[model samples]
Target: MAIEEKRAWIMAVVTIVAYGTYLALVLNAAAGAPLGEAPYVYAMLWTIGGAIVAAILLNILAAIVSPRDGGKKDQRDKEINRLGEHIGQSFVILGAVLALLFAITGLAAFWIANVIYLAFVLSSILGSIAKIVAYRRGFQSW
Candidate 1:
């Protein structure tokens, strides 16, 4: 697989794992209380930080494992990357709008923060999926 494809896989896995861990932590802390009452800020921050570090480390490992492919990027890679980013950015916009609305309506910070976090996770996963699909099934530029 190309280094980019490997990167996509790493991103997808790391994001999913991190989000799942955050969810587990928050839910466990909530116990029988409301989700908004759960101590989620620290968990969310830590998980996000961890995911970023893990993705970077895994990408470095992948580059070390395949030095020849590490620095290679062609037109296809660029196109696929752009396409994936465009596809993934939809979630970010949606999240921003939702968060803004929640804030305007005087919702709890927990809801707004969770919405943003979920959007980020969804963006990463969807982007990674799009890249992997383009790599595996032949990308077509339109």
Candidate 2:
């Protein structure tokens, strides 16, 4: 497979794993675990940190695999990332808006809220994975 393809797979895998972790955290928090934050806050932060760390580690390892060649991302790579970010942002906003709406109603159970929050995070993760796939499939350029 091509380098970009490999990168996409790596990203998708990490995203899936991160989302899975988030789901587990949400479940644990919902069980009243005194986790640091009410129910989803700490879990959300953990998910963010995990994603950041995984992405950073992947980049670092990719560089170590070929330091000279990995030093810079070409225009195509940059564009793909930009587009992916755009998608991810949409997911975040959608999640927040949904949460706000639910909050206004004041009817959602704690478990429901946690699940909604997790759904939003998963949306972003899936968005990123979709973008990578689109880039690889030639649906997205650069």
Candidate 3:
């Protein structure tokens, strides 16, 4: 597999794992209390930070393991990335719109924040999946 593909796999897996861990921790903590009252900000921050650190570490490890790849992103890699980002960004936009609507409707801050966080997670997952598919199959020109 190309290094980009490997990176995509890493990102997808790491995002899922980090987010899953955060969910488990938050849910466990909130078992007796309401979700809104749970300690979510810290959990979100920690999970996001963890994901970033994990991705960086894993990418570095991958590079060291396969020194030949050298993380060279070519034209195809760039195109695939652009396509994946474009596809994945839809969720972000939706989430923003929803957040705005929720805010306008005076919804609780917890729901809005969670919606945004979920959108980010979904975006990463979908984007990584798209990149992986494009790499495994073939990227067709528009």
Number of backbone collisions per candidate: 0, 1, 0
Winner on lDDT between 1 and 2 is: 1
Instruction: For residues 47-70, write the lDDT of model 2, one tens digit per residue.
Output: 768887987788677767875565
How well does each candidate superpose onto the true structure, as a TM-score?
Answer: 0.98, 0.65, 0.94
User: Model 3, 132: alpha-carbon shift in Å?
Assistant: 0.3
Off by over 4 Å in 1: none
Tell me the tens digit of each residue's lDDT in model 1 across 43-74. 99899999999999999999999988865999
Error of 2 at 117 (Å): 4.3
How accurate locally is residue 33 in candidate 3, as Cα lDDT from 0 to 100? 89
Please report, as a residue range, the 10-residue window in candidate 1 with the lowest summed lDDT. 66-75
Error of 1 at 47 (Å): 0.4
Better of 2 and 3 by TM-score: 3
lDDT score, residue 2, model 3? Answer: 85
**Model 3 stretches with alpha carbons more than 4 Å out:** none
Clashing pairs in 1: none
TM-score quality measure for candidate 1: 0.98
For model 2, the run of ten residues with the poorest summed lDDT: 1-10
Query: Which candidate has the highest TM-score of all?
Result: 1
Considering lDDT, where higher is better, how would the candidates rank from best to worst? 1, 3, 2
Candidate lDDT values, in order: 0.95, 0.66, 0.91
